[model samples]
Target chain A: MIALDYSQFLTFEPQHHWRIGIAIYLFLGGLGASMGFIAALYKHIFKKDDPSMFAWSTLLGVLLVNFGGIFLILDMFVWESFLHGHITEIFKVLLAFFGAAVFNGNFHPWIQWGANFIALFSLFGTLWALSQADKAAILNKLGFLVKIANLLKPLQSVWGWGTIIFGLAVAAYTGFLLSVAPAIPAWSHPLLPVLFVISALSTATAWYMLWTYFAKGKDEETQKVREHVGHQVEWADIALIGLEILAIGAYFNYLYYAYAGGKYVFHQMLSDMGFVIGFLLVGLLIPWILEFIAAKKHIRILVPLAAILVLFGGFLLRYYILHYGIYTYPWPS
Target chain B: MQEQQNKQLPNWVFVIDLNTCVGCNACMAACAQENQTPYWNEKWRTKVEQAEVGKGDNIGRIFFPRLCMHCQNTPCYYACPTGATYKTPEGVVMVNQDLCIGCEACVTACPYDARYRYDYEDVEHNKQLFGEEFSIHQLPHIDKCTFCYHRITKGLEPACVSTCPTDCRMWGDLNDPNDPVAEIVRSGRAKPLAVHLGTDPKVFYVGLDTLPAPAKEEAE
Candidate 1:
């Protein structure tokens, strides 16, 4: 008897609907916004005496959150829907089921909702902090706004912690967004969220360091403050970089041992030697080593370069995850 | 209440007899015509895939008609952020075009690669078949095989089943024990694709044992 050919029943084509440009922009925006929120919180809690640092950090956070929100809107298929008021229906449906779905383990909706909530909250918080700092002197000229800022001074600490929590949620939400996709075996891991959070933190730290070193004024007082904060951030980044490496290792190990499909996808991803070498070696490993050296030798130039590499690696990580996510073809039984 | 609801629901299933399939691709053409899908769009709601197996004198080819599996526990349904893709009481999975944000979440969540984003312009030619208010062509929406829900609900067989030249496709309510498709499925001869994933797909295949292994090089 002649056997039927079962394997060729269907041809599986890898989808490229979610382009690399969207992935990179979304990743950068989310990372920048979250980092800005964290930096503002850190300044408020630890360096309250330095009003100038708090103002700068708050301004950076506001700018990043707004930019991130813009990129997210651009990535939507019908972004004009938001402006035309068509998105209200989507919002209405989500609002109706938000509580039930969250309790029922439907976290996809929650992740999207949480991201939006955090973006708005962080934006408002940073702007409020900026007005209170009055570094630009624009807010001080507005008498009514200055009174409101003073009235809200007692609750500033609460807002600071709230922004920090929401920022972290935004970071974790990016990972959760991709992990929920069951088709992509490579991204469906439980540890994907952990890996993403660590990467976000490392990238955030790197961005803060870069901004402090390069974007700040070159006056004697500002230079002294930048040097001090840069040193502290360098140590923090080293620790973040170390944990990021560990997370990456754990993520790959989990994929290799989880199942045949995961293992196959993992090998397939690595087969594209460019991604592994560009993202892992040059993007991650080289930067890690350079950051370590910069920390010990106090090499200012090396620190910024390492920061740039960390950002580059962060972009590549998201790029590779979105572009190379191959759906496991279900072999006919 | 739950028991009453379950009893009221229809159990829809599709049966494909591999022994009778001639790999003629009539079903694919009928589906595209019935759905009014744009000619330029590469993605099809229903498609026939050909696989060549074995080597030398043993070489043989088989045709597999693929579409949305309509699983009992659909991953795409769960992954949808706003409930845009949902399963009806009749066991048919559907995408609500109005609610779909075209985030492609459902597309990525489906293991079958059955769902695709509709990127074509709306042609006015099919307005008579599908009324102007509810034309089949909708831009910037995720689309997949809906089991020909409009026709099925109207007591008509799906276009693919009706147009099949070899009578290889079977469509019926699986809850009826006397239904031929249900009988074939209950006979334990039919196998669901990716049973290990636990999707509990409604579509089942018979005569799989006679099918040759897919060529390894061509699998990519």
Candidate 2:
């Protein structure tokens, strides 16, 4: 038998820097924005006759992008400088350093730059679309803004496609952020990005389903639109959930066959019943099954429950991944 | 003389004589004092790790003094988003406090677990060590052993090396063929920790043979 060195095994607790707040922000923000962008794209590509769906998706996408941005800013340590009256100086330094690092092609800075650009584009695009619809009285009164909105009318497809690409990038970037941490063997995998993208899309579909269900109108024409959108979202979510399960299985299998460090992480993750049972079984598996059943039976109530469960599972997935990341003990050689 | 030229060489490396190490932890204390690290935080730039080998009567204890290996391809350096952690021209890995965002990416990337986040409590000590404006700017930056960059650049030995009672620690240039550390390494006895990891660690253990061999894989 291999003699395990039980002696002198030192494992330190990681400081709570990137905690639940940041995880939630990354998950919800990425999912909401991406789902909204995808919905808008679908509207442009297939349902160009009904531009109202595009308007609703754009509004939700902009709100989510801005909401996620608030949390992100709060998570930064640089924000604390505001209390000491050095916020300006600190921000200037941060911008200068991060700007230079982004230019140099560092992974983290590039992720930050990409996320910011996507959020800004989504926000501006949504507002521009809303303004052109004459929904906002403030925007409608501005003559110059009206002309710019008219000018952008020709590039609606380009704008829609741009948001889709950026939204997908935003979803994947969260995984890349975690995978870059060399200490966390469980997270430092190629499959993590793939897994995150699938999860994000799954959650996005869930959110859209809930939104369409709640926003359903009493009129026959409006009801038809809601039912049609709902049907498409349900099918997409079922596919995304299937892909998520497959990716997760592959991820665990990879870890099990990996080196000693990877095996240790895999074992740790398996042993945590809260994660395995609560997050994986109750959250993901149950929801997936419900969605499948609901689609077949055409159960409207089951759809919302399944959607909520998926959203919960998405949050828990991120929580467990971040919180349970155990740094392998540096064993004596 | 060749010895005189070797003494002035760059590319400093640490030679740790494991056979002579008594695990006194004097180096740990000296490092903490020299760096002005807070007492509450258990984060250490250098410390002694002890493990026992063999069964019952044959059991013997081995002491390993741990510190930053100052790797050639440092994971922390590559992991830093803002290039806050960098390698000096003299081959010393140091954190540029002004640039560090306290994201703790370097702290997580370090294989040896050498880097630590300087929290709000350590602010006063950091200000005293690095000055007011620099400390204010670098409030929560990651910190680790810089191979005593301030002392080494000023032609003084590191506190840990100087304060070690057993004289197990040796700091000198690895580039110089005549340097004692270079000679010990060339003699085919010295070995770096985790050589298989490809970190190319500068710190070498001269009497690693005295310690127990790594555990072998168990039979199914």
Q: Pick the candidate with the highest lDDT.
A: 2
User: Tens-digit lDDT track for model 2 on A211-289?
Assistant: 7777754467756876787888899999988899899899999878875667777877789898889889987899889
- State in Å the error of residue A69, model 1: 3.9
lDDT of 1 by residue, A294-314 (tens): 888878789889999988888
Which is the leading candidate under DockQ?
1
Model 2 Cα lDDT, one tens digit per residue, B80-196: 767778887677899887777666657666777777777555775667766886543245567788888889899888999999998899887777878876788777777887665
lDDT of 1 by residue, B4-82 (tens): 9888676878888877888898888888888876445566888777666667655556677778999987888877766
Evaluate candidate 1 and give its CAPRI docking class based on DockQ. Answer: acceptable
Kept native contacts, fraction for each prediction: 0.38, 0.22
**How many angstroms is residue A290 displaced in model 1 relative to the true structure, after the best TM-score fit?**
1.2
lDDT for B149 (candidate 2):
84
What is the C-alpha local distance difference test score of candidate 2? 0.71
